[model samples]
Target: MFHKVVVTLLVVSAAVIYADVYEPVYKPEPLPYYFNYNVYDDYKGANYGQQEKSDGKAVYGSYTVDLPDGRKQRVDYTADHYKGYVAKVSYYGKAQHPKYYGPAVTFFNQYGNGYH
Candidate 1:
């Protein structure tokens, strides 16, 4: 009987120690950061800008780009663990396409020396 009691006590102590080792602990802390950038190149016709910030729990940002049809496209967004991601899109200018003209030159022969 004494031996059985000692074995049972040892088993209970080992089980408790094992449970403590595997238990998880969590601590929450606020994280904050911000960043922004802009790019404009007249020769390449590239224009864009972006800005973003976060406070661990929530993030907010906006970005703008020059569209090919002579319009600016912008998007504002926010994200968090609860709300996921949401965005609002808007345009700044009207879109326009350049006038199309006739082909620059007449068609020419496609085959060279009629070689097969």
Candidate 2:
């Protein structure tokens, strides 16, 4: 009887340790995932927002800003040298048109504003 009890305790302890050792596959973050646009803020083209066209900017992620100017700004966010720094795939082709772009997960910022 004592041997059986000892074996049971050992098994239970092993399970507890194994549970603690397990690691998650993916890490979660806050919602409305965002980026600091200041890192990569430069435009050489018309700087316009066209949903049909691809906004293929070399960024970790994408964001579209409506500058005081008539033109709508599009941005992409990319992870930096650091691991957490996610690079923008493309901007919200039209920042205002969130619909054109999917949620942060499905969304990627292309050089232009083309959805893939």
Candidate 3:
């Protein structure tokens, strides 16, 4: 009877230890669950700035600002293996459309050509 009790106790303790060490697998839900989300903030009376997602390879981000004169200003930036780092600021709802400054200028301001 004592041997039977010891065997049963050991079995129960092993099961408890195994259960404590187990981890459940994680699975993400599908995209359709977010169909009612706020996708963009570009409309009138809406907030302008938002931070977007980034892939594993690149550090990517974007933001928008509503100008006082009814135009919208947007800035998109990224840093990765290909570009190192780049930023672009632009305007909308106006006649002026500026060009993209090259990455050299951006690098100069950030690190001063590696000397700073």
Per lDDT, the best of the predicted structures is: 1
Local distance difference test, per candidate?
Answer: 0.91, 0.49, 0.68
Model 3 over residues 1-116: C-alpha lDDT tens digits?
Answer: 99999999999999999999988798654231111123445555665555755555666677787676668888888877887979899988965444664555233555456532
Q: Which clashing pairs does model 3 show?
A: none
In terms of lDDT, model 3 sits at: 0.68
Off by over 4 Å in 1: 1-30, 101-116
The candidate with the higher TM-score, 2 or 3, is 3
lDDT over C-alpha atoms for residue 44 of model 3:
52
Model 1 is weakest, by summed lDDT over 10 consecutive residues, at 107-116
- Model 2 regions lying over 4 Å from their true place: 33-116
What C-alpha lDDT, on a 0 to 100 scale, does residue 55 get in candidate 3? 53
lDDT of 1 by residue, 1-116 (tens): 99999999999999999998985677768789999999999999999999999988899999999999999999999999888999999998898987885756544467533322
Over the stretch 3-115, how does candidate 2's per-residue lDDT look in tens digits? Answer: 99999999999999999999999976434332332332357333333222222322244555555333455544444334545533332233233337455544447655545
